[model samples]
Target: MKELLYNLLHGSSTIVTPMDALQNMVIALILGVVVCITYRITYSGVAYSSKFNTALMMLSLITTMVMNILGTSLALSLGMVGALSIVRFRTAIKDPRDTTYIFWAISIGMGAGSSNYYIVIIGTLFIAATSIAFSFSFKKDNKYLVIVRGTNECIEAVRAALFSIYRPCKLRAETVTDDYTEIVYQIKLNNKDQLIDYENIKNIEGVSFVNMVARDGETLG
Candidate 1:
């Protein structure tokens, strides 16, 4: 078992064998598959971009290939960097998490390609577990900004009504007008089932109208 493990880690350096190249390629392919699967399972965004996901998988495989070639020669490494630097990516990333995933995929590929298989496996597993933990935690603390617009006479009534239904709400901002008033609330709630309850608020006496919007922890304009 020790001999087998040593052979896998050190690799055969005497001759450039087809079997060795094939083994490296297979390892890279497996790493790519793992990355792709993890990304798919952990994704939480509103829309899932298959293109981006596919790009991540390909990046893992390609980066590993590049690292393998570069590992063989310093000259090739420099040339590879030059070639990659000239390539421009114009796509705009909406979520900050997407950028992190890109880096993770690249790291996995480079680690495996350089024959640091242990690092690649352990690092990927660690990152994946951390990401899943964070994702679930964020879901629990879901917050939203609520904007309420009504008449001056109804301002207090509005505040009282909102507080009665949704506890732990904070008044973020307020605007006074000749006939109407606009107030914003930073509300942290346990569930979204109470969202439609805002309609009852609009029915309050002296209230002209009530507008409630859901924001992901951002101030409502």
Candidate 2:
């Protein structure tokens, strides 16, 4: 058992040559670019971050380099795992889809590092196609958060105006005081034509103002 442990820690079965290392790095770079482009194309987040997108590609390259250096050495591989475990990411991932992209980038890097080009190429192409196709196939409905601030008197009228335009106008939040009232409603529309006629609610007697904002918090009007 001691002899086996010694061999496991000290020995490496696969020796990475300079040419092979170069090939792996090149493959990782190419696959990383593919993943980055795919992410940009299918991104549905509130903001498109060029820096984060660039980091995705860099992650692939770094992962591949790590794998190549570790090469068949059990001890170094274990140490690498320990080192990685200490790292903490503070950035909040708002969109769940971003996690999938991150995993995809890491997978590509690992595959390239191990010279599994067949699986890497085929899997990447399939995933990219699936992402693109799914993005196009199921269109996202236009969703808006309608914020109405006004006197308590026209609250019902404001609701009526919302329900008249949006079929399923959902009341998300409401703040009511002695004379002031603020109501937030979530509405989904198929197109701009279906958008609420703000004048209808604003024209009400007690309504102070009506504001429409997209799901991403961008004010529409």
Per-candidate TM-score against the hidden true structure: 0.73, 0.85
Pairs in steric clash, model 2: none
- Steric clashes per prediction: 0, 0
Model 2: CA > 4 A from native: 1-3, 170-172, 194-196, 199-206, 216-218
Q: How many backbone collisions does model 1 have?
A: 0
- Per residue, candidate 2 scores C-alpha lDDT tens digits across 41-147 of 98875679999899999999998998899888888888999998999989998888888888998998899998999999999999999999999899776887989
Candidate 2: how many backbone clashes?
0
- On lDDT, the candidate that comes out on top is 2
The TM-score of candidate 2 is 0.85
Query: Across residues 111-193, which tens digit of lDDT does each residue of candidate 1 receive?
Result: 87777888888888888788777776775445667777777888898898789878788999999989888888877666656
Every candidate's lDDT: 0.74, 0.87
